[model samples]
Target chain A: MKSASFHLNLLKDTERLSSSPVRLRVMLPVVALFACIGMGLWWAILFTQLLMVRAEAQDIDEDVKAKSKAHAEAISRQDRVREMRQQLEQLTYYRNGVRAIGKPLAKLAEIMPLKVQLTDLSFAPPPLDPPPKPGQKISPFAPMTNVETQRFVIAGRTTKETPVVALMESLDSAEFERLITREKRVKSFRQDATAEKGGRRLLAFEVEYTMPERRFAK
Target chain B: MDADYTTVARHFQVNAPWKSISGTEVPSAHGQTVVRPRSNGRPPTGKLPPRLTGLHSLAWKLLIDLMVKIQLTRSKTIEIGFGGKGKSASNSKVDMTGVELFSGESRGAPAVRLVHKKDGWHILAAGFVPPPNGDLPQRWEDTPHQPVWELPRNFQSPSAAIAVNSGMSSFSQASAEAILREMSQGLGDSRPKPHTAISPRLSLKPQAKAEEPQKPAPIGRKSTLPPPGTPVSENGRRFSMRPLAEEGFHLAASLPEFQALWLGRLLPEGRRPTAASIQLAESALMASPLLHPAFAETKGNMLAIFVRRDAIYFAGYRKGEPVLWRRCPGVKGYDAMRNAIGKALGVEEELINDVLEDALVDPRPALEPFLHPVLHQLDLARAYLAGKHSMDTGKALLMGLPYGASHWCHMAEESVKMKLVPGHPFDGITLAKGVDASLAHLHLVALGAAIAAAEVET
Candidate 1:
């Protein structure tokens, strides 16, 4: 049995030595190749999935951007439409206001006396005097600028001596003003042939009124 | 008549007598003066010819009738070329009872006495006689001898006869001399005075009275007339003083009406209608009479309303019939007319309003009629830039064409090979994407062609 056992062991050792190089060279390389192929397949699948996900995200991002742009454009268009509507409305309102005040003003103009002619007329919000300067701030003791009284100054030429009084009376009685705060008259010689021949004088007058604001509304 | 003639002859003899009066210048048997001729019969045959019967005919009477008709009533009368040696003397005897003078005496009745002289018979008043011893003796016949009745009274005045008469006419030189004598005798002591009253008054006054009060002698400086005031209204509102070139609407219950309210309100007092108003009326007439036919029918009504509105508007500006258009506020004739039109057409007012509003706001009409076509071309260019339509046909077709054409077969094959080089690498991407890419490339080429075509068309 010992001799048989010794022969078997020798055979086993030879087989092991020859197969070990073959296994190292052939089996290792084949297994490594199969393993590499499997890993490559797995990575490719992952890469494909990653690519799909990225494409989806890009699509979502583009969709959001497009929607946001469209919304902004719609809002802009709405804003333009609103602005146009407001302009048209304002124009209509102005036209109506002009129409409303047209007749009364024309009648007033017609009844105005021949000697008086209005050189200028302006209509807008009443002017507001500038606020006190920073350095010139009002103190408790400082007198006010008389802001309580709103003045309407009427300046005109007159060939008559009493034109200022007549104008004041007309304005007072005609209900054109609530009050006549002040009346000023200055006499000046008019170089007219008739006036100079008669040696008559004319008065250039500036009359100021502090009228009630309610009269204007009507 | 005989007595008058004798008296006239006696006066002639007294005035002028021949020194050969011893032939027997003596008183008649009844103490009337008488003169005896030196020659007792007709002159010798050579010295005087036989009278022709032609002179005795009524032809000379006809001439006398013509002369009396033409010259008796004239302002001045004259006669010329009288002779007594021929048949003319006999004719003169028949036509004119006047004094006659001959070269020799003729035996005849004392009523028709002939004096020895050189030439003709001349008619004279009974009171007039010639000088017997001077050249010829005068024979006087009975005829009215009033000096004032001799010629037309105008001839008796101190006026000149412009021309002398010749023998061819009845108004002759001898007749002219007699007329001048009568006129000179008639003009006694009368003088004419014209412009008697005012002329003396004006002349007696100062010469400078005609130009007195020379406008105060133009004082130191030239005076200026008063200036007409502001062309526009003094109020803040501007007065139109006329209608606009295009009529504008005053909205009345959402309807456009021919309301002259704005017009009346805007015009200043005593403002005159301007040329703009006339042009506005004309333009309104020339345009479509009715705003649009789709809105209304009965164009006459529309025109009437339009004309009335214009008339009132213009009248307000003119200040003529000023109160005609001053109705209650918000009253609109145009709206009424529009409603009437809608009612006539069996349509609702709202529908008409829609139509009118559309007409008012339609940019199509505003652009087509008012805007030039070049503006439309610019719009098309902008649209083209916005990728609404392609600009080329051949390139587009070539890009779209599959590899089937005969001439481009090689190029098509090369394209296919390039596409297939990756062996279906382009699987997931759509074929349309490739087509779009190709089209984009073709579009570049098409842009050039389109520009060329557009240039040609322009």
Candidate 2:
């Protein structure tokens, strides 16, 4: 038989005491207080970080809004620049179409024959294109072709057609190459409205000559 | 007509009948009277007389029930003592201290520390500590005072068991043998001794045997008490019981409700040893001899007489289980015996030990007056065991008395006709270095308290 069979203990469970010096009763509250304080400090740190991050996010949002508006304005200015460039390029084409007519006129005078008394000398431009239709838009600054033909009509009391022909042949020479082309025509010779003092009734003649073409280029 | 007996009356009305023909004579057909037993030794084999059956049983049951109810009512009203409420479950490595308090002397009481290591218990220390100077408070409202004893470093342990000798604590015991004897006074069942010799079976396989011996009755079959661990109240006292190995036998102990709380908290919890178990002094004394070799040699069939300063007690064991525990009424303890020896021989207090141990002097004049009644009671316990359990107690252990053991032994051999063997409480235990073995007798209750409190389950 075990010795417990003879033991008759009178102590109750509640009355038993701890022999150890370290008591949970005294230390429990202190440990719990420290735990609570530590948790509070940790939560405070997290709260501070959250506030700082939120402020940084707000600043970034405002900066993005300002940058977006500036970007839109820059794009509109780029479109306006492209439209002005196209108009300027058309104006440059008009400026390049000017013809040097003074040199050609001076050369025509020099190549005129002495026998041919020139009463009237003028250049008449050739009809180069048909008239525009009703609804078609035309740009005035650009010409259809840089080359042109002009008829040089010569009318005078030339007395005979030979003199006029001689004048035409002289106009076709290399000295008048920039002024006139080889092609020419004689129309009719008729007496002038009044005879010269010598009482000679001269026949009146008309001649036409082709002029060189004028070019417009860069 | 009583309200409490109404149920019993209704029970009898509904039941068919009950009859008792136990040990009655029957007339044979040949004109001769014969006593015949049933073939199966069972009840209700034949018809029985029914005239006074119900009335006889009803009257007896009512009387017993009324007595039990009155006892219970009285116990529940007022309890000023306490019972053991602390559990003794502990690790094998924890050291335990056991002490006996309020041990009749004002100065000090016995104390010891025990530990169970590799094989068995070893004593760390043994001696005495200051007593509780009658500071047993009866209620929680009472003012608390400083503890009388602070265990020395050598005796201090992780846990302590205290055995107190106070009027508030009580111990009692009863067995199935006692019940059997009461049921039939002189009808002794002297059974053959339990089979102790080895069996002669050499077969490799188990074989059925028609010649197997019978075993004793199952435990608690004839118990007259309540279930173990439950309290039983009688004569205005409440008790708690623990069952024994022997069938229908149990050891019961009790303490006042107030006293249990006080004893449990007597040792303040701190650096000093805390009380792990609180028990009565006699209850601890009952287990003092459990570690002795005599118990193991007899296979736990033994008896012991404990002589204390104030009282004498008898403890009986069967198969290491408690079979009997009784305090001798009217007879006093060792102090009374010593006083008687001193007055009879007219010797000084110091020379009293010499007269009893020295065969040169005849101290029968004083010894006979004290020993006759104590041994006569022991003989009665022995006779009761023989009639009921069929085991002969040839020798009984005597302990707790520091002197006059030889005289008590001589008187038993001469007048009582029983052998008395005095035992040392530390006989089967190993003592550590510096532990004094000579003082083993003085720490009987403390040693038993430690042994019982440090119960190692086998």
Each model's DockQ score: 0.00, 0.17
Candidate 2 lDDT over A24-67, as tens digits, reads: 55556777998999999999999999999999999999998989
Question: What is the interface root-mean-square deviation of candidate 2?
Answer: 9.6
lDDT of each: 0.26, 0.63
Each model's TM-score, in the order given?
A: 0.17, 0.56
Interface RMSD of each: 71.4, 9.6
Cα lDDT tens digits for candidate 1, B147-252: 1112221111111100100111111011111211222221121111111111111112356345433332222121111010001111111111111111110000
Candidate 1 colliding pairs: B78-B171, B78-B172, B79-B171, B79-B172, B80-B172, B102-B117, B257-B334, B257-B335, B258-B334
Candidate 2 lDDT, B426-458, residue by residue in tens: 888878899987867778998888776765332
Q: Which docking band does candidate 1 fall into?
A: incorrect
Model 2 error, position A132 (Å): 35
Error of 2 at B11 (Å): 18
